[model samples]
Target: MLFTTPTFAEEKAAEKTEQYDPKGPILEHIADSHYWHMFGEHSLPLPVILYTNKGIEVFSSHVFEHGKEEYQGNYKYALIKDKIKPVTEAGEIDTTVRVWDFSITRNVASMWMGMAILLIIFLSVKGKYKTRAGKAPKGLQSFMEPLVLFVRDEVAIPNIGHKYKKYMPLLLTMFFFILISNLLGLIPFFPGGFNLTGNIAVTIVLATITLITVNFSGNKNYWKHIFLPHIPVWLYPIMIPVEIIGIISKPFALMIRLFANITAGHIIVLSLISLIFIFNSLWMSPVSVLFVVFMDTIELLVAFLQAFIFTMLTALFIGMAVEEHHAEAH
Candidate 1:
């Protein structure tokens, strides 16, 4: 009987070892974390800054040791599912203390890095323009000149007309920021793979900026079209409300489009990589690797396409707002 008991326990342990679940890990990878994760168990912990009812407290995220341990700040705190929350001495989550986390997370750090890269590239190009002064382009200027020209000639001039120059700065900023952020998310190494664009908060801010710009730039014709449409008097109630909704919906659509596309791309790539582990077969590596490469190539194109689409649409909207209404000659 004793021998049989030991055999049963061994079999159960083997079964547990063989079982694999990929959902938890996949979700964790896509979501934001306090520390910037590198390959395997290596990760750089970011600073943890919190504002609580007691006062402000600052520390390192590593103090929690990936949620395996709790740390004492101004109050007792624990990392609950990658979130810093106050906990009671009884080892339970404390609901009374409200915590405002102002920490620089993986996404925030990546955004700063992206902005720095953009500044360095553009500032160097600016200096070249001053020194060269109408000479043929070379090196970094050659690469960036075409993209800048495309946005101006193909995107801006076509939609926004002569007044396009007024909004060119905004258009350029949106296009390059989105393009760089999307490309950065596709990288699989440290300081590059953080999904800055995929984060919803970032998208919301971008959309809000577009919303403010569009409405503020609206001329008299644009205001008339919204509040006092050229429709029958009886349809005023119906069409007026519709026009108001349309104004808000445009930017809302932009927000969802960018957020969903970028996030889905990252999830698909991660899910593909998880397939080999799920199958528990060395043979699955070649098949999974091939699909991952193919998808990555498609994603590379999509990064540019999404940026172009966003800028093109914004220009179109701005043009609509600023267009002059021409009347028929008598």
Candidate 2:
């Protein structure tokens, strides 16, 4: 055992001094960045978009050289912990100027790839449907039909009721988009590494859409329930504020739920993988690999479950907002 320990360790015992920094790399992998990492020092640098009072500037993120040095264009900017900020010639960050970044980051690229995959699959499926109308689906069509039907019939119809058709498109889009993004994030390679849905911004946007849909589709009865709440006149002062808060809270809940769940899964898997390096033991690899595979399989199930819950909850909220007075009479 002693003979093999020194040769097989990930890091020599003499060099292994730290307690293993899991948060640093794990957060990097799961967070948005201007480049897609391939291996050590090898990455695909994306374009950086910035708007400053001076003017708009566009450049390749490679100028930052993976955050080693500042990128000086017509303006000077430094990649400070994956964030680009204007810097002075002395290599100091210039706080005097305000800059807005709308860069196409790794997460954004992953989202685009996920969207492309969706288009390819659905477009092909649509073509197949036209060619094989009313017949049993085969191949990819066979694979997708049940999933589509589940979202349409199981999610949309039951929750949104008769008006479900109008919202079917939105719900279906949410389900497949979240599903595809979640699945793509698990790949840990090109076109799939970044956590798009796991990003709070993306989840916030989705939650906002659901919020807008519910409010816009709300009927007279729905508004009455919020403002007037079928409560005593004396309770109006207390209940009105709660109702208003409830509207914002629902969507907020959606945002946090999806973000936390997905982010936690990613962190857990990364933590397990980090164990091997932290211990510098090849013996740990088998155990680490087994746990990772097990966690990944569980994450796959979570990917589907989360998508379903988000769509289902959205439909339920929309239904409540647009429901007729008679159906809600009881």
Candidate 3:
């Protein structure tokens, strides 16, 4: 079941006393974990892969029983704060031993699923183009054609100029990946609501790719403007540092903007629903449900808006780097 009611004796008793705490559940929903939580007490356990001082350790996350028990492998390991780490014989966190986790967490799994979805979609769209050549776009091609053209015409050409074709793949990938992931997150079901884009680690990676692309694509004029601006030579020392900071800051803004917007949307929706349990009144459900629907409508628009904004800014930054001066053109 996607959602459950208080049916068990203990759960009913807790409801009677109204000891509900929304913090833990809310945080867990927005954060990545070793297992994919479905609803209620049901979850799909994932593999726990760890590199420790003793060597590699692999086990099912189920062994920890959602962190209620400690698992003894190459060395004792415990799931603390949703992370698997080495623990002492006494069950204390063993700080002496170094551990590196390469496990496929919920977010990683969600990313793979999202990637698979994108592959199926674009591949189908690609095949249709050849088979349906010279014909008006129909079916999926008709659906996706406008979006593809939107990125090219509305976003890329306006920002990156004639060189936009080279970066179309990157910009298209960014837009669809983020858009699909955000849409999936709003679903309150097993395969969805994984919070992939809302995670900081994911945003950092997306932003870093943009940063690398922007810098690598920088033209001779781009570097010249940064290192040898039209400023007085005396101000070079100050402007040089500022120019370098600008390069880093652009991507940093992209990272924070996506992470904060998606995360805040989830938090707000969850917080609104939390009011029902907080007040312990069925009367509040109607009001809460109304607000949730309204916010969800807004979130749907935001899902598309954020993806567009991120792609737009990335193209804008690339445009800044690859643009030529009028003097050079002459």
**Which ten contiguous residues of candidate 3 have the minimum total lDDT?**
1-10
By TM-score, the better pick of 2 and 3 is 3
| Candidate 1, run of 10 with poorest lDDT | 1-10
Cα lDDT, model 1, residue 17: 72
* Clash count of each predicted structure: 0, 0, 0
Note each model's CA RMSD in angstroms: 6.7, 4.5, 2.8
- Taken over the whole model, the C-alpha lDDT of each candidate is 0.83, 0.84, 0.87
Of the two candidates 1 and 2, the one with more favorable TM-score, higher being better, is 2
Per-residue error at 283 for model 3, in Å? Answer: 1.1
**Model 3 segments beyond 4 Å from truth?**
1-15, 327-330
lDDT of 2 by residue, 1-330 (tens): 011111123333433775665556677767788987764435788989899887778889888876777877657889887899889989888989799998998888878889999999999999999999999999999999999999988998888789999998899899999999999888866656677888999999999999999999999999998887766799999999999999999989999999998999988988898788777788998998899999999999999999999999999999989888775452
Residue clash pairs of candidate 1: none
TM-score of candidate 3 relative to the true fold: 0.94
Worst 10 residues of 2 by lDDT: 1-10
What are the runs in model 1 whose C-alpha is more than 4 Å off? 1-18, 327-330
Q: Please say which candidate is ahead in lDDT: 1 or 2.
A: 2
